[model samples]
Target: MAANFGELFLTILLIVCLTVSSQGREMMEKKYPYLRLASSFSSAKARGYDYIIVGGGTAGCPLAATLSEKYRVLVLERGGSPHGNLNVSYLQNFHISLADTSPKSPSQAFISTDGVINARARVLGGGTCINAGFYSRASPSFVMAKGWNLELVNESYPWVEKQIVQFPELAPWQVALKNGLLEAGVSPFNGYTFDHIYGTKIGGTIFDKNGFRHTAADLLAAGNPKNLRVLLHATVQKIIFNTRSPRPYAVGVLFKDENGRRHKAFLHAGRHSEIILSSGAIGSPQLLLLSGIGPKQDLQRLRVPLVVNNEFVGKGMSDNPMNTIFIPTKGHVEQSLIQSVGITKMGSFIEASNGFGQSSDSIHWHHGISSAEIGQLSTIPPKLRTLEAAQRYAKTKHEIPREAFQGGFILEKIDGPLSRGHLQLINTDIDTNPNITFNYFKHPRDLRRCVYGIRTIEKIINTNQFSNLAEDDSYTINMLLNMSVKANVNFIPKHTNDTVSLEQFCRDTVITIWHYHGGCHVGKVVDRDYRVLGASRLRVVDGSTFATSPGTNPQATVMMMGRYMGLKMLRERLGRRAGV
Candidate 1:
């Protein structure tokens, strides 16, 4: 039986090469056959949408494909449709869509009350369909200090790098993490570019070259599919407004759809009709304090109904606190994510990932430790530790075998974290999770930029381009970065060690590189033409109008600020109907 017919002809040639690589990602989602005329929420309501966008994710699908190329947009999306999600179309199942704790997961897990767990990006190409897709851009002094128009942010980052960016072929552990970040001085190598340039470059990836991903809902195939609609689970939940004069306005939104039914949508009589939110950065300030628009004593202690008190709608929240290291390799590396970064002019960026596997029912372990036993319990001696003695020495160690969970991690984060926090709510349930608190490193210059980015990842694993990841070539991962370089810093605050400072090991290993942005910032809650200050036709474009967390991954400047604020609100509505 000739080796059982050569193992059934190599499992039918690996299922015909994964069905011809999933029909080349379904021929790029069949070049948007109008994204299957996206409906649902029980086939939507009597249409009236000259722009109603809200969280279709990653700057609301390029701001509803540049306001559907001239108004009539709608998009709503509350997860569903990363079209045939093989964990969002396989870049080797990227951490199975962020360890999918499914309740219709598209990566939504939350935690932060500064205890930090963090997730949020319920699909619809939001967080670029559960990120790791590392595209870069932003940092021409963060587009001339956010007053933008650096030639329309360089022509809106090549119209989103010609639709969901790519350029990544690197993998050989990202060429030894880009020769261990230019042998750790993090210099010169500007090799590839999406330009946020500082040093060790490579950046750009929405994951293609066969590992397919390309989201921001594939830039909605550059819109105008008869003025786009896109509905999917559709959650919105508030922001109706029109509060009878003294400046209130906004006139639409109150969603629900995935059969919890309730609708509403408005804003069509064009006086440059609006209602955008691009729901991110904790869903545009938790839908502006659940539509009462914040702080009148947290909308009268949650008995809601105020419209505009504006105590900076959920104040300045921030996140970018990451701190990894992990590495492991006794051999075979290859698999990747975040093609080598390392920007660091002391504000810290440094990135990496190579070989990410997971799935032993998403192998989570806090008290059971193992991520190389919490990177060998951060090499002990910080006054005889305590995370209950590193969980009893990672519970007498010894696990690591889900096929040796191969290597990767190295991260570092820290940029622009003037350590802020606030986002309260606790209820108003448009799918709960509010009380955020990114108070990490509560500013000591963000713990000296996370101990100078963990001493630049301990000089990028003592360079010599990480001397073939130590199988006795002795870079013993710098003895697990001795006092700091955490093991994915899985939330350490519990009677944390008082000193032996790497600033108390960056306040006992903070974590969250989900690159959190402010609550609704830009001159405190939308101004500079992103509207919303005291309200009108309300606006708040993504990353809650970021006050910092731009380059090195803020999804290509949040999909080029949703196509440069939808081509600057279609040139401020054709320059106010040609009156300009």
Candidate 2:
């Protein structure tokens, strides 16, 4: 009896020890709340979500993170995850990401019908995954102009900044660029703040100390993972609508997985359940048009079944047109993206990137300049049509020496461009890239502003501060300007002082900074609450709904819109419940 009792006691002790050890192991193993998938997300069908967000880019990621705190959320991204993509996570690969042409690459390269070459992100983080990583708050004037609740917008800025924003330790090249801007009278030197001000300011960046980029995807860390489901490579084809009632309601979305397998994700039958289109300027409008929610004439032309006659769906497309000035340095400069910005009173923003534009052979400079045949477009006046004709005549005769170090400054017209462009459907196919026409420099004021920007960059390079780093002389400037022009055609430099030549130069050299916005303007396509006009349970939370371009790098503003909209939706739900 004593031996049996002792054996029983030993067995019980071993079981207790094993149970405690197992519990400790479980505690140490961290399981993220969100379920991430590359394909086969059919489980989304079984469990309907409270919120279904399309295009898991900049705006969608943060919005999902915030909304998931209270509601079940699904983010369907058309591209792959940026988590392990070096081209997306590293600051040095900034241009390389944009230059990537692989079909599966996150950055989808496209040329506008007007002949401008640019790229839009197809990744989970959207533009933040591919952009220069510059971060800044929208100007107060912009917030007020949009009639946004300033208090709410202010509250939302910190939520995004805390996760991704970082003050860059100025690289040597950025430091030199800052001095040059100040010497050239950019003024006031707003140090380290994210405020959008007219001066030489060192703004925030997304790149961290180790040079790893912290994108909008990081914001998901603050979310309830169990409430959020992020499906990557899930391309949304169209929004499924129920027109049984007078007002058409977006009930769900039809998206395709990586294997081109179709999947349907539906919003729960809850009172506040909604489908938000945060697919960005181009993607949002394109998706809307594809779903037959655009101009009646356009929808009829494409033989799409009409859902709404909102003519403003794909109109009012505006992008910040940039004119770049490249400078070749004798000594090597540390490679950096946008760090210091020269916000000029002249209605243009001047910013520089180091170690880019080093190779004339790179796609950003070579193919970008050559393939853009803006001359064929009818938007240009007959007089300046010679500028387009010049594209065929211009040729890049002298390539910059491979050993020569190079840096360049970009002049962005951000105050408010007078010219407005449009995006139209080429077909009903969701996979096909839309026809984008950025009628650049259609207005005379836009042309004058770009010319002023180029001259201002010239002044900065000529300043004593940049003299040691830049080639200063009319000959050098003219040669560099001609090189940019000739990349489009084989034209010779003529009448360098004449306004016609300068205007021609502006027309030929201008490219998109990719701050495109306003295909779904607030007063036109969507209400102030960002809900689509003449529709129910649908909203646009990306740059697509901007009234006008905010005069800065727009990533911060786009994220703020997502945050602001997410909170506003929550408030609206509460108000409804209270019968307010």
Highest TM-score against the true fold, candidate: 2
lDDT of 1 by residue, 1-580 (tens): 9999999999999999999967754674466554432333332555667778887888788878887877688888888778777767777666666645667888777666655555787878888877778788878888888888788778888888886687888887778878887877789899888888888888888888888888888788788888887877778889898888898888888887766768677877666688888888888888888889878987798788998888888788887787665555577576777877878788888787656443445443321111333222333432344436545645654342432345566768888888788889888887988878777887788888777777677677767767567445453434443312333222222222333457776665555658888888888778877788888887988887787888888888888888888887787778646421
User: CA shift at 407, candidate 2, in angstroms?
Assistant: 3.9
What TM-score, over all chains together, does every model reach?
Answer: 0.34, 0.84
| TM value for model 2 | 0.84
Q: List, residue by residue over 398-445, the lDDT tens digit for candidate 2.
A: 353332234444344545787888999888888788988878889998
The lDDT per prediction is: 0.73, 0.75
Q: Count the backbone clashes (under 3 Å) in each candidate.
A: 1, 12
Model 1 has an lDDT value of 0.73
Residue pairs in collision within model 1: 57-126
Q: Ten residues in a row with the worst lDDT in model 2? A: 368-377
